[model samples]
Target: MREDFLLLNPGPVPLAREVRTAMSEPMVSHRSAEFESVYERAQNSLDYIFERSSLDGTKTTSGGTSLVFNGTATMAMEAAVANLAGEGDEVVTVVNGKFGRRFKRIADRYANVTPVEFDWGHPVEPEAVAEAVSDDTKVVTMVHNETSTGLLNPVAEVGEIAEEHDAYFVVDGVTSLGGDEFLVDEWNVDVAVTDAQKCLAAPPGTSAMYATPRAQEAFDGEKAPFYEDLDWHLRKAESHQTPFTSAVPLFRGLAVAVENIEEEGMQERISRHRSQSRAFRAAFMAMGLSMFPEKNDESEYSNTLTAISLPAGVRENPDAFFDAVTDRSVSISGGQAHLGGEIFRVSNMGNLSSEQILRGVRAIGEAFHEAGEDVDLEAGMAAAREQLR
Candidate 1:
């Protein structure tokens, strides 16, 4: 692998130098005061991210607690459902992509799941969600950004439906929280989850969630998994710690990562992500590639990752195209599940510079050429350059 290989996959994005350096600091005991201070620093920064993640300064949330756990966002996804819903309770899950389906599967384990399904790569309809949720529903779960198809779901619209029905609203903001606009309280989100590896640009193995007072009032400790009881997690958070032995190094990395976000400022970071994503889409279009997802009035393209359908030539031999990309010292992702070989996804998350985004466009264009496709490399580069400007 090249020393300067670039990562354009959706999660586990390239980390900042400071974040990488912080993770290598001498190992500290989880119970030590030093570690507690580290946890406090991370928690405070995360609070800033959660509250001030809006693209504009018009939206902000307060009076909620942020909890960090020793697992990825999937664990938090389960905790959100387990602690709020039980057997016989109905959970309305809006499924448009892989992550949304995962929420339904998790909800199925603890509650009766009612899925408002849509074809992958298609936007979710708020009217469908409104029809699915009712007063009898105990929970409503949605994925804010469906990374698989590069589509952003309508969280605020669905959140209003959940709020109207008086159900606990749990949103998987795994890919959107730090990179895009997420108005938690404004959207009536009771529990919102995100990962360190994704938008936070930290190392993998840690995740965090924000729980509103309403979620706290509805929490049931016994129903939650032994290792994922939010009630116990909340108690431990008061002292700036976790209920179990935490990943100290990852927390250190996360602290530095969120502090980096703070220094960059949420508005500037969000704008960068948006601009990069636009550049990616523009480049792909100029190369004659079509986007994978279809947008609607309520939902639109993801501002962190872009998914493009493969050209006929490349789709016939996707591995060769991907190999060409890797040969260029760049790594992008193929589609997941049934969409495999049909589409490729690239991420604009993390602290990537404009130069890297342009390089990614050039790499993809060159790879397509290598795969015997007729993509206009110069046109793609020019389109991307214009957007980056």
Candidate 2:
């Protein structure tokens, strides 16, 4: 409750005071031993948050490694495809939301991409993905959390299908990792990418990827140009260094963010997110606001964020709703692409508290009223409280 500003967006989430303080610490040379110590600590923390014992991508071992890139998660997504897909390699990409479409778009640039598309709010069916993957398919890409619509895709099932077809499974876990439940190796995912922002509650401009030995095999073929090359990353990772000048301050912030997560415990962190999401959804539903995502069950719903259809009156004057919310010192997100003005997203990611969510819901309810909508704020608050209780 900073009172000055509150972020409810999926990315660039509200950082903890400690994480922000870590970023303010004096910068160190990327090649210095001090930086190496920081790098080693970060890697160890990331492995724990990623639930991997090791970095080599094996689920059974505790010594797996993850690549920390000084860029957005989108860069990690691109790197995953660039290293795993090449000329004549068929890539089966699941497209159910904005991020999913992004994976397809990225894959299309380097491989024969077969996109299994769904509506913006609909979940990607694993059965359809199974049908899309062929013997010639070299990679399968998916977004674990469809952030745009707050829908969770069946990544575990799709991973099984990809493994059955002997294809490398790459996941865009930008918004899901650290906040949601994800098992990289158990799900047979060959590569999974996530950023320092979003669920990690750290500053942006830094991303990480967990790649297995099998996924690394794709680098044998035509590799991406120097910057996107995973081979160079792996070679440099041995010494806790990056091939290029690393974002030292970002590393410090991310390491502290991961430390905060460790202090809270992953299961407890995930549970908090789930409870807040459920409370928000329940409150909104009680206020007669429908969810934008077309989920068949709770499992298909995202715990990091919740997307709600725009109120009828607000849809006609969406800016009023957004502006009203912002005026209340709470910053949320609007729908993207074709869904713009049709829905609004509220994130409960990072270190948000029950009081914060309660206040956010009330503010949005007030915004609904400001937009000339008939919403029962009392009912919504009551419902949210019940869920939180």
Candidate 3:
């Protein structure tokens, strides 16, 4: 723990030194008023981050209040889904990546879930979303940025279409939000979900959603079982409390992370991500590797994760490739199931910079070299550094 490890994986990435220090802090009693103040400040600070871009929801809840922390982002997704869709109402689920498919699976467990799936590496078409909606449709769920493929579904367009159909629009912004632009209000997004892990640069365990008054009103119509109930969270959150104890260290880390993001300035932060991403892509291309996403649709590109397609006839070996990078003391991820072995997804968003990007490119070259492939790693490194410039 004395020396920092570079995290180029999709998540739980290398945090800023400050974040590590925050996480190093000792625990405080969850019930204490001082704890509530920390919780309250955290909530308010995040509201400023997610909602500040628009004139909407700025109330922050700390101590796992503004955000539902101490759990994976899955908890936020399930809570939002279970509360909004009800037992019998219908919803549209767009699946392109592993996470998207996972969301569909979560929905299938519920009563009236209709999945609108697209081919892997393909974006969800607006028409497909339109076709999936039915008279019974109560909600529309889609992943804003498909981390598995680095292809973004047009959540803004999808949001408009869903709203036009009078359906509640719920989006999973897990890997996209902080690194790029998102519209929770103008897009008329009733439910917006994201975790602090990826683009947020905060530690894991803190996940949150933006629930509009309309979304809240709909949830008010029925009683949710136990902790799945947003009403319970609302009731307790209004009083600055959570139904259970939370990860105090994680919250402290997030508080600092959010401040760091603000200090960097959102646009500049996004630009930095774009710069590193561009450089990373250039380096890959120099090595004859291509991204799963196409160029024209780069607007739909994800800033957090880049899914690189395997080189032709190379016979994909994600494990081998990832191991190459890890051998260099940094970590990059392989694709999840279905995409596994076919694509190597590298993370860019976070506290990472051009220096890490340089190191990462060199690692990939080392891997190619070990594989006995004739690769110009120097060229890849040069291209990457140039793009960063």
TM-score of each: 0.98, 0.95, 0.92
Per-residue alpha-carbon lDDT of model 3 for 195-260, expressed as tens digits? Answer: 888888888888877677788878742544466678877777675667778677887788788778
Global lDDT of each candidate: 0.92, 0.85, 0.75
What CA root-mean-square deviation does each model show from the true structure? 1.2, 2.8, 3.3
Stretches of candidate 2 off by over 4 Å are 1-3, 52-63, 294-296
- What does candidate 2's lDDT look like per residue over 106-204, in tens digits? 998988989999888876778888889987889999998889889988888998998898888898888888887788777888888898889889899
Question: What TM-score does candidate 1 get on C-alpha atoms?
Answer: 0.98
**The 10-residue segment with the lowest total lDDT in model 3:** 55-64
Candidate 2 least-lDDT 10 residues: 52-61
| Model 1 / residue 267 / CA error / Å | 0.5
Query: In model 3, which regions exceed 4 Å deviation?
Result: 53-65, 221-223, 293-295, 312-318
Clashes of 2: 11
Q: Which clashing pairs does model 3 show?
A: 39-62, 39-63, 40-62, 43-60, 43-61, 44-60, 61-66
- On TM-score, the leading prediction is 1
What are the per-residue Cα lDDT tens digits for candidate 1 across 18-133?
A: 88899999999999999999999999999999999988855478888999889999999999999999999999999999999999999999999999999997788999999999
